[model samples]
Target chain A: MTYVVALDVGGTSMKGGLVTRTGEVTVLAGRPTGRENGPEAVVEAVRAYVGEIAGLGRSRYAGPPAGVGLAVPGIVTSATAVYSANIGWRDVPAEAFVPSGVPVRLGHDVRTGGLAESVFGAGRGVADFLFLPIGTGIAGAVVLRGEPYGGARGWGGEIGHAPVWPAGEKCACGQIGCLETYASASALARRFTARSGRTATAKEVVELAVAGDAAAAGVFGEAIEALAIALASYVLLLDPALIVLGGGLSEAGAALLDPLRERLAGRLTFQEPPPLRPAALGTRAGMLGAALLGWQAAGEHDVGADWPIDVLRGGSVS
Target chain B: MTYVVALDVGGTSMKGGLVTRTGEVTVLAGRPTGRENGPEAVVEAVRAYVGEIAGLGRSRYAGPPAGVGLAVPGIVTSATAVYSANIGWRDVPAEAFVPSGVPVRLGHDVRTGGLAESVFGAGRGVADFLFLPIGTGIAGAVVLRGEPYGGARGWGGEIGHAPVWPAGEKCACGQIGCLETYASASALARRFTARSGRTATAKEVVELAVAGDAAAAGVFGEAIEALAIALASYVLLLDPALIVLGGGLSEAGAALLDPLRERLAGRLTFQEPPPLRPAALGTRAGMLGAALLGWQAAGEHDVGADWPIDVLRGGSVS
Candidate 1:
């Protein structure tokens, strides 16, 4: 069977996979993003990664890889990387980086991850749901009627910048009291450092909170409250059936989810509260989603059926 | 040529109409909701209003009324009036009230108003937009891809209850600092009364602010700030192409729109701002939208063409 080359590009690393038509990750590989060198080096790194995957697909699969899919962070409008603070790139023609003559698909990393979750992960079987990744900054992927809604200008998922506290703190986006200022992983770490005068990663903060450290607990509590308010806002507007939490902060698991569910429940009065579930695929979701998009680009009609829920739940693809 | 019977049921009144297939309001009438009598009384009032319109349709139109459409306040699910605080209704089988032999369509008033705006009023020609009515309470109707989205349980559009200030005043919905508590017309009036010990309508408060009353200016300013925050949240989530404001508060017109637009501009950092415009149809939007829904129930295929923007702009049907 034919395969597709998929790449999930992050600031620090790139995950590459040769994905078969049956949703199997036939070959998986990785490489440093090399952004320390500069933007052009990052571009070259992405190109080489895709080349390696395509080579592996050509030798191992029934036919040459039919298409390539790339998932990049930041504002992606119609396949062009508009601007990505993570990659330090501006207006990059991303689709052109793939091998010539191969059909290619490009998408926002969080949105692509959301698509995978909606079809094959935690959000499986839900007609309407939201996928939120609380990493360096918070953004959401609104899945309505089985497709992601990009809004009028593809700026739909900037949930991080939504002002949760209008008079509270100034956000990096120049808005006051944005949800990301308190809820994102980076925000949790930053707030913990500011409060306790000890630098720690968000994971460390979660551990500290679990260990009953008052400072860490307070910081995490604030994050949970802000997330709850922002999510309540989303529920009122979209009425999603589920909210799938992914990204670095979600790695905190129950410590993050339990409080978030409680806070969200307390805030909603008339609206039905949706379940908050952890991302099952972790980092693999983006690459798998990119492969799905690639299959679509290659004119595969049964891509949805290819990645059945049963196979995903069994963890056979990863 | 067949006609449709339509009723826009409100807390205090029912606006009834016999509308032709071409968006023409052939006859219009009104009756007291008699809600103080009881929920059952209100139901009878709605039924009587529809019956009157059906009678008008039979005599005035070429053929008998082919269908009936009803728009009501509060949560609506599958043509069932689930709950309405305004009408004191719960699980009311609303379709049962319509005379047999006539096809019936039921929807939330705000959503049907949004539908009319999407096809014939301020939001015409847009694929996605939000319709918000700032009456006694704030609610939104999100129109996507030319149809109104009611969400999973038809409980979408309850934007009034979306918490804007976690530590602010309590709302009727039991939430604190909800957008409606600060931004809605009733909120403005009530807050003004509480602060100044003066009973005044929201319109009077707007007039006072315009005439340089410090207390009124402060209350109205808070309202504008709350509206901006709530709207920013909506923009970050749905990213509608336009936001059409209707109901009593919208009657303040430039007094309301000017400051709201300015405050919203300051909050959005990366997202392209959608235009905020006054609802073109005014109060008639609800009735006209009900009529449109009635036509759909009657099997009118060319309703979109019949509702060209020019006719709606002319205000002739009203």
Candidate 2:
């Protein structure tokens, strides 16, 4: 059976895998990106990771791998990695990183993860929805008619930069009161540190909030309020059936979801509030989505197909 | 040549017209809606206007009228006028008002007007754009890939309800600090009257601002600021190629466009500010858009076609 190489390239690490046509994934070794070295090193690391995954597929599968797919953060178009703040790359000819003669597909990491969720995770079978991953930074994927919506300039899902409070804090993006300034994981940690002079992860902040710390509660409350305002605007504009929250903060689970749902519902008067659910696939979604993209690029499988049938059959993948 | 009857139903009056296959439109007699007489009178007024326009088309055109199209306010879906605060309509079977033999099309006035602008006005040939008609209320139409984007629930462009000031005034929608409370034409007039204890139209408020009345300037300035905040969010999300402002306030022309452009540009940090243009088709856009829909329902014209080719030729349409 044919297999495909897939990679989810992040600033620090590259997650690689060899996925069979049947959606069975053989976990391949990861590599430190060494992006701190430079942008070229990052590209080289991605290429090397792809090579390792291909080797694993060739050793285990009946035939050579069909293609490769890469999911990267940034302003990605279909053919190019336009710009990525995380990777420190601009206009990178990312497809060239794949080995010669192998078809390659490139997509934004958030959108690719969204596609994975729409197929196999929380958003499964939902035609119109939003996938928001609030990690170090916030970004979103707008899934419409079961496909990611890339607006006119391929900037359809930059929901994090939306102004939630016009008079609020300044963002690194040079905007004031952006949703990212308050709701993103990095923002939560930074705000907590500034107020309490204690360096804590967003997870720790949530814990402190639950443990009855007033300062932590204040920071968390502000983040939730900003998220609710931004989401209210999205609900008015898109009216999606559901919103799936992923990324690091989402692991807080009900601590994050309950308040967000209540605040968002309160903000909406005539509009129906969309159901909010946590992403089920965790960090593996980007890799799975890359595998799906690889299958599509290889022309061996339809991306439109309800994929990972094994997962749908109530089976787990290890 | 076959013709279509189109009516733009407003709270106070109905603007009717007969449009030929060649895009030439003959203005038909208007009718008072007398909405104060109640919902039945509103529905009857719409039906009578449609019949009058159909009769006009039959007498003036070479063939009998082909179809009818009605543009109304409120939460309109593909088939039903789900709700209309302006006309006090709910789940109205709007298509039934047209004569049985004629095909009929129903659409929201804002979306229809936006379609008309996309085909023949300021947004002509622009694939992704926004049309905001800030009349009594401040709803918008998001035109993506040259068609109106009706979100999953057909509530795609309700920009007015977006919260601009979380601690600000209450809105009829039950949301506080909504953009409509400050920026809409009626809002400007109402705020001015409530403050100065004198009644004035939105147009008169603009005149006062231009004449250096500080209180009027304050109200208009607040409206401009609120509009800028909401538009910044839209730009961050959709990145439309252009933004077209229509309706009563747009008649203020440079007065509305100049400061709004400056404020919007100032608010955008990384994203390019879309060019803000006044709607060129004016009040007649709704009627023209209705005609296009009528032609489509009649199966005589492709709504997707670059229609009203004459308008593109720089010829006048009155």
Candidate 3:
């Protein structure tokens, strides 16, 4: 068995762990990703975290790493970080940041997470699936034959940018009517905050909607409608076998998925509706995806990779 | 040199040809693919055409066939013929119709056309490309790495059905506001006829638009705007290297591509606009894709098998 190092860098935090081919993760390590000083500083944090994790794993394990896979958020150029809309970085070299000889692989975080789900999570046994994370941002991962279909530049699966409504709401990307403006976690809070003049988490908004609050319910329905609109467009293009919703809004589970599923069904003209399910691994999907990719790079599975509990860090399509 | 046979079937015509691996066509044969009598009539048409073409090729050349590829319009399931909206086909047993002794393959017409373009036509050497056929209908083909990416159920690249206006026009598929209503050859004729109270062909409308006719120019500009909108959405998803417009509208050449390029470029926000080119082969793409698939099935090329062609032909994806 060989150990695989996995890193999942997010907008707010950096998560790392040593994982095995079986999806077991240990020697978990994390630190603030430190986006305040800009993207280069985040790179430093990543480097430091990876060094410590690799050192710990080496002291505890019996074999060298099989490979490493890192997941990052942004417009990736064939898994190479090109720009992060949230991280404020331009053309960050992912493989270059890691020390030589590690054989690092980089992919969009959502793509990796969706890959994890396709292999081990909710998407197991499904040949075609879409993992859409409705959180602070709305993005998707298209999994085909257990692999994510990363577009030419690896910036594929950016469904949020797909223009649906003409001249509706302005997006930060300078476009109008982005699904993110209506369906993301930030959208939920913003919608409620705009009406009630009080900011509440997406979770709180869901609770309010469930307790017979008409305004919150209306906003919730709008979010569901937006999701239905966005997903219907995707269904027209790619009829995925399953759709697994992840990230913050997904935490509401049936409260969100059930309505969204019905709304999507109502919107379909001819194609069959894909199954909607909750993401099983939640945030850990990133770690599992990294480990899974590392194993893929190694070309085989290694159970011993899990035993090195102390290992450090890490890292689409429609 | 091994000879490859390609077949493209439209609502009214069936186009077939023998092409070399270098994308050269030696023999071109065609017949009216009459579907009024249902799927069986179409199958008979295909078998008779293939027999005549393949027999003549064998008589003329000592080399064995590389492969055979077939393309059709409609909703293909896992590369198998399901229900075709344009041809009025349902559950057609395409594979049983092909001659059993040799390799044959099937695919969506536009996608296979895209395959032909990517391998031997305008999309050669393009890393990512979308082939849009603006004919009786406006469907598309997506090529990545010189191979078409057929989505789930072999319906991937159905750009025509993409919703353009929610409450605009009711399509035959029971949907409101499809891209097909604006950008297709039929759309141009319909728009012109609606404005002038006289039935006219798209070619005549284009000619009028070229000669500074106000009404014709308005319809032509509308078509260009709709094409720009749909293609812009496609760019957000895959960001392909090029957009190759095929079919009858492509006959307009620079008049269609130049203005469409300008309008699409003007609408971009986060994406870098891709160049637009006219499809090289007007109607022989399906035959070449069929031939490519046949060659692949014959173990000539390691390219994987596509599903829809499986029913019309025999081959395996490597």
Q: Rate the local accuracy (lDDT) of all candidates.
A: 0.83, 0.83, 0.74
Off by over 4 Å in 3: A27-29, A58-66, A77-80, A85-101, A196-198, A296-318, B1-5, B20-24, B27-29, B62-67, B75-95, B195-199, B207-214, B302-318
Q: What does the lDDT read for residue B157 in candidate 1?
A: 82
lDDT of 1: 0.83
Q: Write the per-residue lDDT of candidate 3 for residues B1-318, one digit (tens) a residue.
A: 667666778788887776555444554646788888777778788878777777766775655466666777776632357778767777775564466666666677778778767766778778688888888877778776567776666666767877766556776667767788877899899989889886779998898999998888999998897788777777766668888988998999888988999988866776678888888766666666666766665676743233222222222111
What tier of docking accuracy does candidate 2 attain? medium
- The sequence of per-residue lDDT tens digits that candidate 3 reaches over residues A148-267 is 877777667878776666457777777777778878888888989888787788899999999988778988988887788777767766667888999989999899988989988876
> What tens-digit string does per-residue lDDT give for candidate 1 at B59-143?
6665668778788888885368889988898988757758767787777998988988887899888888999989888888899
Candidate 2: tens digits of C-alpha lDDT, residues A1-318: 888888888778888877767777776556788889888888877887787668766777756679888888778875688888777888877576787788888888888888889877788889889999989888888888788776777767888999898888999898889999999999999999999999999999999998999889999999999999999999987788999999999999999999999999999987889999998778877888888888877986565245554432322323
Better of 1 and 2 by lDDT: 2
Residue clash pairs of candidate 2: none
Q: Interface root mean square deviation of every model, in Å?
A: 1.0, 1.2, 1.9
Q: What would the TM-scores of all predictions be?
A: 0.94, 0.93, 0.87
lDDT score at residue A256, model 3, on the 0-100 scale: 92
Predict model 3's lDDT versus the native: 0.74
User: Which ten residues in a row are the worst by lDDT in model 2 chain B?
Assistant: B309-318
